[model samples]
Target chain A: MMLQFNVLAASILSQYTDFEEIDWNKMWEATKETLFMTVGSVIIVFILGLAIGLILYETSNQHSLAANITYRVVSILVNVFRSIPFIILIVLLIPVTKQLLDTMVGPKAALPALIVSSAPFYARLVETGFREIDKGVVEAVESMGANKWQVIFKVLIPESLPSIAAGITTTTISLVGFTAMAAVIGAGGLGNMAYLDGFQRNKPAVTLAATVIILIIVFLIQGIGDRIVRRVDKR
Target chain B: MIELANIKKIYETKRGKLTAVDGVDLSINDGDIFGIIGYSGAGKSTLVRMFNGLEKPTSGDVTINGSKISALKGKALRSKRQKIGMIFQHFNLLWSRTVLENVLLPLEIAGVPKKEQKSKAQELIRLVGLEGREEAYPSQLSGGQKQRVGIARALANEPTLLLCDEATSALDPQTTDEVLDLLVDINQKLKLTIIIITHEMHVIRKICNRVAVMESGKVVEEGHVIDIFKKPQQEITKRFIRQDTNPDSEDTDVALSQLLTEYPEGKLIHLTFHGEQTNQPVLSRIIRQYPVELNVIQGSIQQAKEDSIGSLYVQITGDNDVIEQAIQQIKNMDVEVEVINDVTV
Candidate 1:
């Protein structure tokens, strides 16, 4: 029976040549591209998402007409960007990305699209996190004579850190996937390697190895994210 | 002194204009433990919030320490708030911070020197009796300990005015007593003007020297705590005092039945004592002066700041004429007597 199984595997392997011979040099370069794109977008998204979330949270649930209008405007802006499908969003941001970066091909070109799509998505999580805080805590800080800046830094931001950290973890994972998707448009990464050097070249080993690496990256992101969330979540 | 003149707060809701605090006037002296007693939505929170300018009045002025709180705006209002501190029923402490750090918040906000902030926070942690727990987070503490942290944080700025918005309401009865005791200790030691807002009359009777009874967004009765305890003016005020007098109405009924069965021929008389009169040996005097067996059926003596206000229900078993004479004598001593039941009146 073992000889029969080996014969069956050989017959299946014979149809695909170079299936075990994954080019390590190209794989390393693809990994660097994916990591570069993800890390860059994650950094930019963190700041932009936090600012957007703060504006959205502060302006909402107020009595002033100006505040209501500001909330409405910002809310619509976030929703518009967040609701667009990521695949279409990359293509939609082509002209803007080109005008901003002067070219739109390699991993660097995917940064703008990745940030624009995920930052607003992450902002919603940040807003929900802010909402989870007891309004009374805000009042208590206000009673302490804390100015707006102090309230944000001391109470609002620090209190919502667990949520923020969790949001970033999810965003970073999505960014990894986005990096792969951006490769469809010739932005080189593991996804581009899988498509151009695996599927087109008929080498399934490259595709399988790329999938394993992406999954590893996601698991690492989640593990580190959970530790961070637990460390900050005292409540 | 804190003076509020015709302070009114009206909130605009989608349905219509809602009156939160309507035309209320109050004056509180320094070193006074003032209580604003009211049911939920009686405008007590709104009125108290005006003290720190957390909520501005629509058509009145709040004057504290010679500055008009209602008239102050932006930076002026914020700076004015520094000298005034507030605590909440939930002990709204930042769970992200340790006890020491929580207390350091107000000091840092006020721009107190970094060197002094640490020591001052440590001093307040010790003040609230949490000396060894300074490094602990609020989540690791009990409800009472959290309130202690809240108190410490509120007092971090050395605020002259402290507002306790149902500060002890969330605590158990024992914890409530401890927190109240801490407030009393702070009041005496620091001479902080404390304004307490509570629906529980027990709190007012325990610590407040002066009180205002709120009903439907207005102060229905305002006076010394002893006076209100002795002679409740309005029906709402009487209801609040009654809650303290007989916390469980069912218990009172059961007690009356037991007392009636134990002494069928006995006289059941209720006596009321005001302020300094509570300390007098009136009941002993009654027993000593008359040839009667006076079994004290039920009794409660409540301390109201400087004095005690008490109520007692006594059953007298003796000659009818002697019992009547004893009741008359108690009335003559300025102790009001009412026959609980007409069995032996």
Candidate 2:
């Protein structure tokens, strides 16, 4: 058993030091590219997501505004987009994505698809966060002469921050996961590097290394996410 | 001064249309602590919410000061709402903001400049006796402290009218007294008109100058709190006053039935006293002047709006003529008298 374990360890080491093995500098660049895409998309998602979420919430039956057919139609549209699979959505929007970004398979080109997919996801998160807030809080603010917009920003947003923080954390973790899948469409990231260096070349050690690095990234992201959630959530 | 004229609120639920507030007229005078008392869903909350325009009436008018608020909309309605501040049963302070920030929210929405907002919030916090808690979040405070923060926030804009929707219903008995005392202090110092909605009659007796008793979406009886307590016109109001002033008064009926064995020929009467008329020694004077003997079975004294009021249960031992004359003379003193002769042997 000892001799078999040594052989396995040596074989794994040989895969890393083999000719045409992954360049550490190039691999690090791919990780940086993945980080850039994930962070940028999250920023866009949150800003647009919050605006859309507030509108949806304030336009519902629970708000002072009476529910109407037009609002219901808009809500249906949001729900429909939210139900579409992300990768499938990317395929379906290829024509529009290419037209807008001048290409369909790189960081810049993937920006719109990333936002389109994640904004709806984050909007649902925000809507649920706001929904958990007490209706009495809104009524109290409204009685103070706060108009709808003022109530939303000054009362609703501040009151729902902890829930919103949780929402953002989970959304970001999934955001990083999504970026890995973006590699299947020619986006530059660790996924692309792992595919070419590990899968295409039949390098088992390279594949194992890429998988481990991915796990480490996910672990770090979740740890940071949990710390933030704990700090913000008083409940 | 506030007047609610023939106000009605109908809510359309999926089951059917329910009348939360039926046609009701109410007059609350300036510097008066007016209480609207009822059981849950008796339209007390719905009626109070109308005072601040939180709930619009289906028909009729809400005239505050002089303006008819039911006709106002948008900016006009919002401006009118500024003149009326309200607190809730739940103490709905903004959870994320500090106590000071919560107090400053209304002023900010009302367009108070940045320079004066902090000072105004500080003054209001001091008034509510939460000066040192300005930086604390609502979660960091006790229930009473949170309500104080809510009170300070409501008073930040210096509104002439303050509406309390079951304000102390959420607190313990001790904390309820403290918050009630604070409300009394605010009413005295600021001379703010308060409309309090509560199910507790003791709360009304403690601070309210006048009260309206609601039942089945209507004001069943209303007047000066002293008069209402002394001589309630509605059966429901009478029952509430009876239960509060004498919790075991119901069991007194069993005791009365037993005592009826001794007074088989005597008459039993319930007498009510109100105002300065109660200052006269009526019971002693009856003993001195009448050819009758009076036995006190149950007696109670309750104070409303700083006046002495009470109810007495007595058995009178006298002939028919003497009993009639004695009752007539007692009625002349402006006290209510009722005969409860249904005691089973």
Candidate 3:
């Protein structure tokens, strides 16, 4: 059965020049790059965003560790980062990206830029998630003698899990789109494959394949996120 | 025992500084179900929040069981809070957690051992009559059930003091009674000092041993529940008492106006009977002793806790001298009589 499938695939590839010209090895490498950039950036963004979001929530609260100066500073930082367009953000973050990754032209190099661009956006979403939680819940937890850390870990985070999961899903998908843009900086990925091989070389079939692969990744992320949200959402 | 001395909370908003709680001094005895009754924005909530240090008093001190709660900071304050549990108008259960988990939260915060936390949470769940719903989430429960979980969670740490901030105002009448009964039961069984803040006088009448009537951030009157019901001092207290006795009726002024138009030539008298006086046939005795015609207009007799308070409006038709004598006789019976109107034909 394997031999038969391989023969059929070869015959199909032979009928289309774009398919025949496709470097299967390079395509796999691009897929791996895309996955690496997306997964790495998402992990970094999740941690940084959660911390920033928590700080924003705590400092802004009147009763709970309310640091007005800290809140204002963080608020302005988030707004400034969020205001920059993602493409311009990548160019602006080039120096920091180079400093962090020691390179500026591969999937690994794209990660710092990806995280810098998306973490604030995700932080704002996470801040909203925390804000959406009833203040009474926080008060109730505090009244139970929960210290600041306990309130954040045990009550705030757990209660806002569903919303945070939704934010992760949104950020992850946007990162996928951002990874495609990362390819413009010579960060090899499906985006680079689609643009350099398919669009520039006029190979529509390669572009279609890359698009399908990205769509599948997005759908999988969405499906997983939705399931988590459903399981976690008691309200 | 919880003592609040000259407690005040002033909130500074964009407009200006607004005082939510004015200089209020109150002492809640141990094992007593004390209620703070007031309308919205009357500062009862702020007062109760101060008990657990959830709201910092702009001035004054809160002492609980010899420790100055207001003076506590950091770990001391957190430890102090563990002994004082609070339930909200909204149940405030963690939506991501199951009933048992929500109950276990306080235990977790106190760093109770895992095994002990499970057993304690289970016991509290059963205590709140939620035995089989340990795995159920709060959103899946009804309002009363959610409050039951809140009660169980609040009790998980075995808190000596329980603060209820309008705990039943969000519930329907029946649910309110059920929750109040649970609180009464908890107070009795555990000897917990429960401070309830509510806008509903009926809630106070049902469960509070003592009540403080608050108006515009001040405690206008504070006394025994029965005493407050019998002789309400402030206009707001009287209004609240009137609501408890006659929930659906119009205000006293409107009713008095209607009665005056109906009975043009009579002495309109408002009579109030308290405790043992409620059982006496004072009206009948007055009628028998005087040659006066009595026309009963509107009345309500309500049982508050162990005490019964009854109020009646009657128009007496007779000569002025005889009506005055009849009023004296009724007052002599320990019934409070107020001459509402005197119109002579």
TM-score list, all predictions? 0.91, 0.91, 0.93
Q: Whole-model Cα lDDT per candidate? A: 0.90, 0.84, 0.87
**Model 1 C-alpha lDDT per residue in residues B224-307, reported as the tens digit of each score:** 988787777697986787678767645655777778877778788878897677889998887888998987766787666677
Ranking by lDDT: 1, 3, 2
Candidate 2 lDDT, tens digit per residue, B151-196?
8888888889999999999999899989999999999999999989
- Residue A123 of model 3, lDDT score: 93
Residue-level lDDT tens digits of model 3 in B1-345: 778899888998889999999999999899889989989989888788788888789999999989999888889999988888889898888888889889988998999999899988998988999999989878789999999999998888888999898899899999999999999999999989999999889998888889999999999999999888877778788778877887754665576777788867778988889888878988888888899999887798887766778988788988889999999999888788878763222
Candidate 1 chain B: minimum summed lDDT over ten consecutive residues — where?
A: B336-345
What value does the lDDT take at residue A152 in candidate 2? 83
**Tens digit of lDDT per residue, candidate 3, span A1-235?**
9999999998766544456667778888888999999999999999999999988887886543448888988999989988888788888888987888789898988887788888999999999999988888888888998888888889789889988999999999999999999887899999999999888987767877788889999999999999999988878
Ordering by DockQ: 1, 3, 2
True contacts kept of 2: 0.70
- Candidate 1 positional error at B94, Å: 0.8
Task: State in Å the error of residue B258, model 3.
Answer: 1.9
Q: Per-residue CA lDDT of candidate 1, range A1-235, in tens?
A: 9999999998767644455568989999999999999999999999999999999999999879999999999899899998898889999999998999989899888988999999999989999999999999999999888889999999989999999999999999988998999986678999998888888987777888888888999999999999999999988
Whole-structure CA lDDT of model 3: 0.87
| Model 3 stretches with alpha carbons more than 4 Å out | A1-18, A61-66, B251-253, B342-345
List per-model TM-scores for chain B.
0.86, 0.90, 0.95
What does the lDDT read for residue B170 in candidate 2? 96
